[model samples]
Target chain A: MPSYKLIYFDLPGLAEPIRLLFSYGKVPFIDQRITKEEWVTLKPTTPFGHLPILEIDGVPYSHSRAIFRYVGSIVGLIGKDPMENLAIDSVLGAMLDIREAIVKLRFCEDEAKKPELKKALEERYQRTYKKLEVDAGKNGGYLALNRPTWTDVLFCYNYELLRNALGIDVLTPYPNLQKVKKTVLSQEGIREYLKKRAPNPMKPKYELQQDL
Target chain B: MPSYKLIYFDLPGLAEPIRLLFSYGKVPFIDQRITKEEWVTLKPTTPFGHLPILEIDGVPYSHSRAIFRYVGSIVGLIGKDPMENLAIDSVLGAMLDIREAIVKLRFCEDEAKKPELKKALEERYQRTYKKLEVDAGKNGGYLALNRPTWTDVLFCYNYELLRNALGIDVLTPYPNLQKVKKTVLSQEGIREYLKKRAPNPMKPKYELQQDL
Candidate 1:
């Protein structure tokens, strides 16, 4: 197996999925977390001036989604074929759209704009989740497949983020999505990782480990 | 071969890459262009309520990037290995970052904030292009490899957008990127497609066919 080293901040933001993938496969890696002060100096050295870089063997690679896909390939969590991958990528894209809206709301500096942003985000996610619920129901409690895939894991993280970060229970109205989270959490490797992983510094109250 | 149908607006915004891929491979697809009036009726019917949906043998798929990757795979423009895909995806991700900044700037409702957004976008693209220049130089004019991949085609479209939409000649500073554009435009299939494809409704002045 190739040596892997993942570098990011201490938070369980974008890098958490990569870490979960590594843990799911029981693959050994150096999970290097840096402080904001250190990131100021390290940012210049990174390929795209971003965190969550995975160094395979010795070469550094950026882009969180790219790294997630590569790691998913390594862990046998990715789709079996091109068509299957298309399914996975579609769901991933929808989740990302919601995440983008949440990020926009989180970073809005104007106090007067928060309610409108939050309202738009609610509408967006509700619509997306309605479609995702049907997909999960058809796939037998998974997002892109009958069996668990990396997208299910991604949904689990997103579920946590919506709850902890935004104080929203995004999965309650959809039983199938709830099932997707349960299926992902039941995986042995994931369960073990959740138990041992560090709490997200930003949102300490609702870690996945708490559920485990 | 499966019957492919690409549905999008008349503008060559997101769906152009998919169209270019099909045209490059000489694959037949229904290039369905809908007006804003048509979109109102079509939006709720779409899987994710978005334009640029691709129906593969009658099953519709949403998400532009997902469709792009699927078409790229069908046309044999994707990477041969996971590592190669990492390279392609890294460059694709960078280009997407720039695109996002451009979109944000374009949609800014506050005229007073446009200057700050524009300055930030300029700095962002310049820094990104410097890194991409070295990569293209190393790859012998392509963004990810020695041969043109789908990302090179994406760059060509982005190049046109930057030029005609934003009135910025993005490739002027980077000879290697200019070479990349030349290399993509020289492809027989791509050249044919450009020669016959309809002019971008949004940026009619700088249609890529002009370069051909």
Candidate 2:
């Protein structure tokens, strides 16, 4: 067995899909999670000062998408054709678009600015959800190449992350996305992986409703 | 020659490298650019409400980076090994990081936020430039596996975009980037391509001078 180690914060923000991929593919790996304080200290030493570094046989690789693709290739999930690969990539870009917008919301200081930001983001999410729904409809219920691939795994993780972190009912907005999430989550290996894993460490703050 | 038509707004932002790759490789393609006003009218009909769609014999492919990679593969740019391909992708991801930061700064409403954003961005740019410099050094100045490839063309276009749009003088901070940019720009076909192409239409406002 080839030795693999995934180094990241003790969170599921970016590395969860890779972990899920490894699990679904039955590839064993060491999951190394660092605390927030440790990230501050250890980040600069990592390639590109980022986490979610994958080490295979002691060689380090950076960039979450690239790492996901690498592991996905091993799991036979990355698409088989160039156009299929491109379709997978387009969906990933939308995921990043949502993530960047949410990051902006995370960094905003004033409460007054948040409503406006939230509205803007909600609008963006609605549009994105529509696109994903259309793609899902056309691509045989998967994002690309007519089968459950890495893009499906990615969509599941992203949808679940938004639910766990944003506190918003993402599925309420797009039933197709909700269905996609449920379908992927129900997959045999993925379900088994979820059964063994602990509660998500990256759960967002807003999931808890405030007591007025 | 395979028939292909690349559609984009009349700007050199994301579509130029693909254009340059096709040009440099002497591959025939339809360089279709629409006006910004036309984009405003037509975007509602587009699959993702964005331009730079490549039509291969009439079937449209969206996403700039994906199209670039597809064309790059045909033109012999994508590397052989997964590791090498990931390295190339990291550079592309870093370039997007810089572009997203720039885009955020462009739309920020509060003037007070501009200064900190610029400072934060310069720090990020320094990080990218440093790593890219070292990577280029290790690879003898090209950001590709062997000879100059589409990745180098993309990097060259990135440098030109920064110099022309942002006007931040990044080359001075990382001399190696400047050298790599110079090397790619001075290539025989690339130099000719630049000379013949019109100046890019969408110039950055550079409006936050007081904050700078």
Candidate 3:
């Protein structure tokens, strides 16, 4: 098997899910984190001058979603069927939508404008969570198929990030989301990975050691 | 096989590549378009409240990239090898980066600011084109391996849109990009599809209708 080396920011911003997938699937990988200053030098070396890059063997691949999909496929997190994959896409894409909203808000300079942005995000988040709740309820435990696919890794990572780091109390609106989190965290390999990589902040919203 | 109906803006926008793939692969599909005002009314029904939805036997698939990948797989545009697919992802992801830069400039409301936005976009476009030129030269005509994949469709579409609609000279800085465009447009099915699809004002920055 080709060695997968994931490069990203120190925070779990985008690399966490891939890390979780590696751990969950019992795959070995190099989780390389660089400082912002180092990224300034590293960016130019990247294919698209971006981070969260996955290098298989020595070849590099950029784009978080694309990398996620590739990793998901390797770990059997992608479903066997197309429809199941589409269901995964729906939730994953919605999460991307949520991330885009967060990116938009992150660029806001005014402290006073933050509350409005937060409120807007909360509204969007609740609506997304409600849909996820319905989907999770329908699926038994997983997001799409009964099996835990990459969508689950992504969803679980997102939930953990939001709840642990963001302190948003967002998942409280969706019981199924909370349940999914518990289910993923309870996995033996993932539990051990967490213990081994203790105190790693899995979301950008959280500072080091605070969420842990 | 499931019947697929792709719905999007009346103009090409994000849905064209899927249409192109379906046409090239000779897959039967319902080509559905909605007017701007119609989109206002219809958007609410869409997942994430957006258009460019692919209804696979009445089940809706939103998010352009996911739909493109699904269709790419069906059409054999997604390479046969895993590494080739990863390379394709690199190219496509890079194309998306360029497209997003163009999108950022597009959202600028101040007309006076457009020139500055355009200038930044031009520099970025030239840089992206240069990188792609190198990749294309290194990997034969296609971005991934030697065969034309969805990366070609993505690049051709973006190249045309960047050249025509965006009114930027993408070719001047990167000669190899123009060559890749020439190679893709020569494909029998792709050539026919472009002819029948009407003049995509969305076509790349440099392509003429006859070239399609």
- Candidate 3, superposed: residue stretches over 4 Å from native: A81-83, A111-116, A164-166, A198-212, B111-116, B198-210
The chain A TM-scores for the candidates, taken one by one, are: 0.95, 0.87, 0.87
Error of 3 at B190 (Å): 2.2
Error of 1 at A73 (Å): 0.7
Q: Compare the candidates by DockQ and give the number of the best one.
A: 1
Give candidate 2's whole-model lDDT: 0.72
Candidate structures ordered by lDDT, highest first: 1, 3, 2
- lDDT (Cα, tens digit) per residue for candidate 1, span A1-212: 88999999888879999999888888899999999999999888888887789999988899998887888878888787789989988988888888888888889999999999998788778888899899999989988877777888888888777676567576779999988888778889899899888866665567777667
TM-score of every prediction relative to native? 0.96, 0.86, 0.89
DockQ of every candidate structure? 0.75, 0.44, 0.48
For model 1, the docking class works out as medium
Which parts of model 2 are misplaced by more than 4 Å?
A: A164-169, A172-179, A202-212, B105-109, B164-169, B172-179, B202-212
Q: What is the lDDT for B40 in model 1?
A: 95
Best by lDDT: 1
Put down candidate 3 lDDT per residue, A1-212, tens digits, no spaces. 99989998877778888888888888899988888999988888877677889999877888887787788888767756546666776678888877767766777888999888877766667777777788788777677677787887787667655554247666666777777777777877677777777355433454212323
Q: Residue B47 of model 1: what lDDT? A: 80
